[model samples]
Target: MAPSSDAAADGEPSGDVMTYHLKAEHELRIEVDFDRQVTVKLLSGDAEIFGCELPKGGAKTLSGVKCAIFTWHAAQIQIVGKPDACYEAEASAAMRSYLNLHTALEERRKAAVTTTSPTTKGPRVLVVGNTDAGKSTVCKILCSYACRADAMHGGVAAAAGHDHWVPVFVDLDVGQNSVTPPGTICAVPVDAPVDPVDGWPGEAPLVYYFGHASPGENAAHYKALVESMARVLAQRETDDVLARAAGLVVNTMGWTDGLGYDLLLHAISALSIDIVAVIDHDKLTAQLKAHVGSQGGDVQVVKLPKSGGVVTRDTNFRKRARDRMIRSYFYGSRSELNPCASAIDASSFKVFRVGGGARAPNTALPLGATSRMDPLRVAPLPMTRDLERCVLGVLHGDNAALGDADVLSKPCAGIVCVTEVDASRGKVHILQPSPGSLPSKLLLSGTMRWND
Candidate 1:
């Protein structure tokens, strides 16, 4: 496709549209800028964005995203607007590798379905990689493939005596979470392919607030959330045979050194991971293999090459993405959401922060004493100006009976943002998803804040 030389005063697309014919096993990689929008439509043949099949003749608008339109067979696509970067590649080893891994996992799923024993459950895969190594993409592709009945049954109809797989997608990346807002980890069952425009389904995600983007801020708190999530998923799989056979696809944050690496290992054990997919990192791969050997587990550590089209996002870009996630929660992605803002007395709900207290230096302590603060302690947050623009996690439990330990493990119902705090009237204004009172009065605070 050649660049158009059309005249448009506002820099929008005029009449010149471009079309590209992708060969078999090829992909069209595109990167759109944050400020601009691009429209893409499939003209002919089968093509998919991420793993969701593109609807023929329907124009899908994309902005501030870097994605690929892949086709197992040949495909023809049309573009109406210019992207920051666009190109078609004839070969993509990363996509091939992802498909192969999906195939092996499918075999495990089939075997799990044949047995009622929990020991023969399907593969629980944990994907670990550096930032921008396409870990999220890998997870999405795997989950999408798992939900594709045609792919599983070799082009046969799913109604032909076969049930669809509902594999669980666990997102541990707090900084840029695809399942839920930032500063939290969540899991959702994927019964269908994820939308290319809208990432994951939002029906009933199990979310835990970590209060900060990076796990390094409170590594203990993060690990506790992981353990809680694993426990809940284990119970869920135990009760549901299909979900157990479908298993899980876990995505981890891109901090793979020292404490970060230790957290990864802890997650593997906590989640009962069967396959550890290391994306484009040899040292991490080897280290994981060695650790698995020492632990005497059946964890298969496979190293996969990172896609060349994976874009490296800077700090500012990541911050903007996080803000978008927050904004999207209250105000939908296309401004389709109308959140209700209400003013309630400050005393109506209790806001608590997890982990942060005065800590004396270890050097200043007695010979055998440790001055470390309890990182899991939950303390009440004072209502003040600091609460302004802060995002609060609405916990799911009895407000009066919730203990500190419950705060650490309880799944959040939803999130609310503090719009205004009136100390004079002892009132606080908050914006929530629906037009009703909060599900619970126990709110959890973290470092996440939204301007709007």
Candidate 2:
């Protein structure tokens, strides 16, 4: 609902500040332009952004984002600076369903605490839907809810020989990842509420470089990466009882047709996902249900409604968001990071691209059969001027004896961008976020590029 003329007049042309009074179960959604900033402060009562509780009287400065400030009870909020759009919405229905689902998952976690069966595990939930359906928002809400539960009952759980509830958030959406930068898939343990401004923390995240915005660019490689992430998660759950009980909340890309659909099924099986939450998409829900029924597995497919507060972003907006994400990795979201720029000998390390090599010649193939390239092939790329402005994933572990298989399965320590390739000097100048030497000599290349 638009603020009345009286409310708009009080601040619009004067101080450029506006006050919004929201009733219970209502939300104020605002979309801040990429070039602007908006400061949000909770004036009175209780409210939260996504699932993170907003600090009373504290201001959160946000830019280039579209978010909702939801209040479970009546509240007053103040906004400074003009956003592209702002409105109030009644979000009781969608929020209620989300809370109910969280409650059900919580019950399972409680049961897992006392269960002796080795086969028993917490809810391995997967969220799937079309583009702009609020899949990532749902993931954040669930993770935050789980973390809040842990904060309240962690001491009790610890007393009973259980660790704090730390839900693993697996993000398979390379286009707009939650934890890491774009063109990467990662899983991070969430034990605290995700900050509305800063998002998920970067502490000890298991990251893999997928090298492209969409999985369709290399479906085989993407599936392989998914399997690798699942393997690591399985091992973690087996070793930690609390983590096993706390379970996982997986976020996937918005692609949900053809190859996208096939990849979803593969992820469900590889991750042993038990709960498939489909948001506001009946066709996807029905397809998943039928497939699950035919396979006769323990997977539960549930339909969820998308929040009305979600604003649809155009292609240009998404591109700008991706660019900002990459930039934030080096400069920090608030320009608090001082990325080191240094030059290293080209021969000191190696760069490799996966699955883009040339196919075998027709003469080498059998008659009447076509030659096809191996999508998993590891091809070494030469250091040259062409590598300038390219983003590279710094692979972890021993690069001394890396092989094709290791390249596909190995996780990255971090990422760097090639600023300049000095061919005459045989040096590669790179921009690194931290002021440390490269962890390994193995670097992976993708199609992502950044100039600044």
Candidate 3:
């Protein structure tokens, strides 16, 4: 049966509390209003947002999330709070194409096993599109399908004693990373379906901090991180048979013009990508085909239609998303993690900024010198009020002997958000993931700051 809605008559506006009864294989698409919050709960049956399953009888609040709640079987759900639009839609044709691609990859994986190939190369998919083009969604679906295939084929357990067949998910979009905190590039191993609402659970992702929200802001640093991630993925593929057969699903940022285009090309070469799926843009597809063809690389450029469910997000919405990601890092998606918030003497820790606080304009720089600053240059920052509310990356290296460049190049152990800066008492209160003294006194500061 199709969903039947019932609104309350208690003087509140309609849709303030609405019930939906979704038939099997139906989805409830919610396009949330700008700057509005929506709360949804599974009243009966089973439904999921993204990869995360909804609680059996509990509610999940989404602020600035435009998503589809889908179920393979019949389910009913109740939604409170306001939404700009709400409707039901069957799975699109693009989803079918994605599944077909997965089927082909599965065949290749099986063939490799049968032939006993030394170097098994499965599908290395790279997803690229403009902002809000649903690149991440495509990647998520592909990863989920791969996980499901593993489970069905008895890939869950290995003859050599392993837990599951883990596929590598390389998140190159540092600003909106699915596997780790914002401002960091991560390569996560996904063995199961991701949480539909909560995203990739706080797994142990290999992260490389880029120290900025946008790749354009720190192009050199971003490129370096991408290279690092690609190397990591390459090494993992060589070492693990399941990982090599499962291959990689790389998610890129939505900067498809000029330098962004160049960065995409760089990633293609660096990752040795075999398939490039260009979403919803004919021009981008043409450009990628031409570029890849000219280079004589064995890359298949495929154009994918954008989903009707994809909601275009504006600047404010993007900012809110970033903030939410940062908050989710420390507090978790369900606010279940108890992050430590304590005041420490400012003199106890040394804070440093990377890339000399952004590059100076060519006109402002000395004659004959390039405008771009050294990406690995780190400068010590004096404790001040400006440092308050800034996110600081706790470095893994020792503070004493490391040079400026070494400091910027090192990966961070964790991060802390400055809550208060007490100059009078020389103390700074910070919110961190755990209690007690920090692992390292050397902290790396960046342009990325989270108000929450």
Candidate 4:
């Protein structure tokens, strides 16, 4: 059905509300304008937007949501916001290309089963692009389509008592990670369709904390985490038939210049990516083509169009997004989690910084010699005032004598946000995931600090 526009009256003051009625098997697609916001609510009947289920009588506010399609068997929705543009299209052409890619992978997966050596794997795709280029959206679409295909083929695989059907999703974008909380790189198995709106559910993904919001904060640390994740994924693919057949779809950060480009190359090499999908950047696409060709490897570089509906976010918006991610971690997206708040003695804990607060230039250090300070050094904190309002990573390792490099390499059990710090009393107030004492007293600090 066509959308009907109405000016807000009485209780509704925005005056930009539009209502749409959808029949069975119909969809209403929307593309919010650049730098604008949209609020969508299910008015009646059963409806869902993306993978997230809309509350029966609640509304969801979307900021910088580029393009979203709401589908339902029979339902009505009231959208009280203006969009840059909105249209009804069955599917974009880029989606068709993605499907073709999936088809090719499926053929490879089947061929691998017939080969004498079952070590042959499907395509390992790495999606890279600048900010707001719809990298995440493309990853979701690819993952969802792959999951659907797996479901169709699962019955036969199940009859054989082989259950390795789900594809693996590696979230390397710590800035806006979909599988786990922010400041973490995760690897999750996707056996079912991903919620388009909510992305991946908060699954217990294999996580490694980078302890910073941006890659530029500690490039060495970020690259180290990437290598660690790559090693884990490689081992899984080797050991698990399903994972091997499914391969990996790695979603990366939007940093495509200078050190960002260097980090990207590091990831590409470490993951041994077979396909590099560059979204809407000619320079980056060309660079990857040359780099991969120069390396004498059979890596395919394909260019994908950026959706017109992608919204560009400013600095403030990104900060808010980070804050929301942290909040969602402790409280959950629907406020379903009840985290515990506790106070502890500051003297009992030791806070360490990773990568030694970024590296200095080679010129700054003496020739043929490095700085005395180590990049992974985990020096002790004096329980000073700077500890207040900072987010500290709860280390997974129990060894208190672990060196700085060892501590930086270890994954975190969870995170705690410091609320207050009292030097005289040696008491530190923190918001933690559970009550009682923390898992470990070896807390690692980074440049990331949160107020709420």
Output the better candidate (1/4) by lDDT.
1
Number of backbone clashes in candidate 2: 0
Computed on alpha carbons, the lDDT of every model, listed in order, comes to: 0.87, 0.88, 0.77, 0.74
**Which regions of candidate 4 are displaced past 4 Å?**
5-66, 70-91, 113-118, 151-156, 159-164, 365-370
Give the TM-scores of the predictions, in the order they appear. Answer: 0.94, 0.94, 0.85, 0.83
lDDT of 1 by residue, 1-452 (tens): 33333343344355446788888888889998778788888889999987888989787889889999999998888877778888988656878999999999989988787675777788899999999999999998898888885324332224333457888999999999998999999999897899988889999999998878888888888999999999999999877667788889999999999989999999999999999999999999999999999989799999998987788999999999999889889899888989999997898889999888445678899999996688888989989989999999999986587788999999999999999999999999999989988888989998888898
Per-residue lDDT of candidate 4, residues 211-306 (tens digit): 777888877778887887788788887776566767788899999999889988998889888889999999999999999889999889998877
Better of 2 and 4 by TM-score: 2
lDDT of candidate 2 over 219-310, digit per residue (tens): 88999999998999999988877778889999999989998999999999999999999999999999999999999998999999999987
The true-versus-predicted C-alpha distance at residue 336 of model 3, in Å, is 2.7
Ranking by lDDT: 2, 1, 3, 4
Single out the weakest 10-residue window by summed lDDT for candidate 2: 4-13
**Which residues of candidate 1, in runs, are more than 4 Å off?**
1-16, 150-162, 357-364
**Could you list the CA RMSD of all candidates, in the order they appear?**
3.1, 3.1, 4.0, 4.6
| lDDT score, candidate 3 | 0.77
lDDT string for model 3 (80-165, tens) is 77788888877646666666777876776665444457676777889999989999988887777677664223442465354434
Scored against the true structure, residue 409 in model 2 reaches a CA lDDT of 96
Candidate 3 runs further than 4 Å off: 6-26, 32-64, 71-84, 112-118, 151-157, 160-164, 345-347, 357-372, 423-425
